[model samples]
Target: MGALSVDELVGRDEWDSVVRQHRRPFVVYKFAATLDGRIAAEDGTSQWITSAESRAEVHLLRAGCDATVVGSGTQQADNPNLTVRGNDDPRLDLAIVHNPDRQPLRVVIDSNAKTPADANVCNDAAPTLVVVAEGADASHLNGVVDVLKVKRADRGLDLPAVLTGLHARGVRAVFLEGGPTLAGSFIAQGLVDRVVNYVAPALLGSGKSGLGDAGIRSMSGILRLELVDVARSGADVRLVARTVRSR
Candidate 1:
């Protein structure tokens, strides 16, 4: 769509990010894990799991989506800025995807509104939304970032409702940067459409698994994926696959 038409001639009256048609945004989740499927060490150290090249590749993916989501655990643990980063580093790929300013909305799933006011995700680089339970204490986050109150689940905010809300707000795509437990919840509910797993060569015998329990009680409940593409990103292997929707 870029090479032929729709170049700088394209302009938006409002924030309508529909790249494709659907009831809700198309979700593509990504994670980097060890050879043994660990996401972090027992001490919660997860820096530099993938090489610089592998990490750089993710910027392109973020630029394609309307929203980039992470759970509160990730925000607290990583303090990710979550932008495409080309605005910070011109050498990055965000400048190549579209307008460098056309970045994804940084979303944090903080059921209790745990996000701090000075969190890096709340920076001015991009818009941010903190999804919390119906009556969460998001008052503390008011002037800093947008707060979204959704129905509370047994353990967290309602996952499906969060997507429905974003869909209403003109978000047609979502990039889920998971923190294992949140990713597991999305998978258990069959919300994730694609999975981009970055596997490093090293191994951690125990720590946080790349994914948590996906509500699998037996083998029949297992979720399978069809591998679409595989490539070497520096020393790591990038696996891109689509979920084989059973239902």
Candidate 2:
């Protein structure tokens, strides 16, 4: 009827309605892609996929969240600052899944120390939380970022525990802007709360798809969504969908 609240569009109410309410943390996923589901061009270049206005909208989404996360692939590809800018109160804490000591609160999910020392996060003036699993190669990076080594029996970053710990640090909401692998990890874990897709009117058939083989076995395994709204942004289509779990 009236202009919807951000929460209404993202299904916060439905999420709260679930029997197992996610008290640990809430997640918001944001990504841009072409109409044919391509996230990057054939050469792995993706800049200005969404409009400046849509980028501002994403910053607005970041403004409302406590932490913004990205993966090492995205870190290497986009090298995003991973923080909100150009808003009334822009800025969100950053969380990168790489070696924190080698990088910045870069969280290394692997049990080995392979991150380089000159990663951008390490050079940036931002607080970081480097997460590492137990028995990881202890070869340290020369104090570029803070290090917090966590033990994971599964030999992978314990994402649920990571979220719980983040919530403990007052991160009520977390925004994930990772590439498809990390996004797929969250989706497979059923940890994604909602998704915002900015669809551009173009095609890149042989590049990376927005959601690669992250683990969706079939069409049924894809995360179901309820289209809440769609609006045109120049020649682009900004589609907002709420995950079924939230509904």
Candidate 3:
């Protein structure tokens, strides 16, 4: 089989435009983890787990999407500015910016309005949307940032509703950025259409896992993925896989 170009590594058959016309926005849960499936150290220091090349590829992945989302925990910890800012690292294949002018919407799934007004995500780099519960008090953030209210679920805000809200705002694709617990919620709900994982060569013996409680108790009910693309980015291996729709 011939090798696929880096830009062709997304885990999808249909173009995002086609998929967006269907249900909610297409969701891709993406994370970089150690060889042992640890996304962060015990101290929660997770910067630069993968190589520079891998980090650079992530920019391209975000650019292809319409929004980049993260849960409250991730927002409180990382305070990311989810714009599709190009990386400083030179692309191994060729140094190119996929959409230099494109800035995907930054979305925060802050069910309780936990996002601080001064958080980096609230900056003017990109438009920010904070998803809170229907009755949650987001008045404090009213003028600070845009807010969307969704029905609450047992664990958090209804993820399906969040997607629906995003779709209404013209977001066709979402780059589900993470901090394990949120990723697990998406996986458990079967809301994620694709999984993009960057595995570093190193290992973290014990730390936060790449996924939290995903509602998997037995092997029989485990979710399976069909590998769509595999590539090497610097010293890390990037795997792009889509959830198998059929059991």
Candidate 4:
């Protein structure tokens, strides 16, 4: 048989399980970090953490998801145009076969509506959804991108509500590419079903960690993950794991 399809690698059954349990899209937190688990340098410089091959793998993951999500901090820092750009491989032309014309919905959890109107995510490359606090002023993004106002949580916008809103819009799977705090919030809330981590060989002794405080105070409170797959792309090692929910 040929290489497993993206759906198989991502596990559609797992996605369905999450939807059945929470009535929302399955959430996968994806990120690249240094060997020391730092996502960025001390001054917030995070350009090109992983190899090009690893980045191409990320695009494949994005192509398989119904929606791509990020936090406002990530938006401000990277200003990425959250769209899938499949690699140029004539032999493996899977990305082109999956929704060539349409791009996955780009969702940003911006509690304060601080996303710049001219941000790349606000461009027409893909449909953008901005989730803000109920009373936050979203007028700035009114014409630039779609906006959803929800109750505020400790981390920022209510994450579960945001997922529900995405589900209402027909999203079944969400690829969460974060800037740390947002990823931590999803894990702390037990909303993450899977994690795709790309670990580079380099190390940043003291910098921005890949995850922020996730409310884990005791050893028993530690979150667990069941390793599903592991592969190497250049100097980076990609580890795909599913959250082992506690009983």
- What is each predicted model's overall lDDT from 0 to 1? 0.77, 0.63, 0.80, 0.83
Which model scores highest in lDDT?
A: 4
Q: Estimate candidate 4's alpha-carbon lDDT, on a 0 to 1 scale.
A: 0.83
**Model 2: per-residue Cα lDDT over 1-247, one tens digit each:** 2223345555565644432366666777788998888888888888878777677667557555556777657766765565445524223223322322222223333334444566655556455555556666545654665555665634246788777777666666677777787788777778787788889888777788887445678987767887878887556777877678654
Candidate achieving the largest TM-score: 4
Tens digits of per-residue lDDT for model 1, 174-218: 889978889989888888877888899999898899988778899
lDDT of 4 at 230: 86
1 against 3, candidate with superior TM-score: 3
Task: Write one digit per residue (lDDT tens) for candidate 4, span 1-247.
Answer: 2222458666777678778777988888888999999889999898889998788778777877889999998898888889887647443455444443478899899999999899999887778899999999889887789999999987787888998899999999999998688988988898888888999999889889988888899998999899988878767888888888921
Q: What shift in Å separates residue 210 of candidate 2 from its native position after superposition? A: 0.5
Comparing 1 and 2 on TM-score, the stronger one? 1
| Two-way lDDT contest, 1 vs 2, winner | 1
True-structure lDDT of candidate 3: 0.80
Instruction: For model 1, give the RMSD to the true fold.
Output: 5.5
Q: What's the distance in Å from true for residue 49, model 3?
A: 0.8
C-alpha root-mean-square deviation, each candidate: 5.5, 5.6, 3.4, 2.4
lDDT tens digits, residue span 101-153, model 3: 35788899988888988999887767889999998888878787899999999
lDDT of 1: 0.77
TM-score versus the correct structure, for each prediction: 0.86, 0.78, 0.89, 0.92
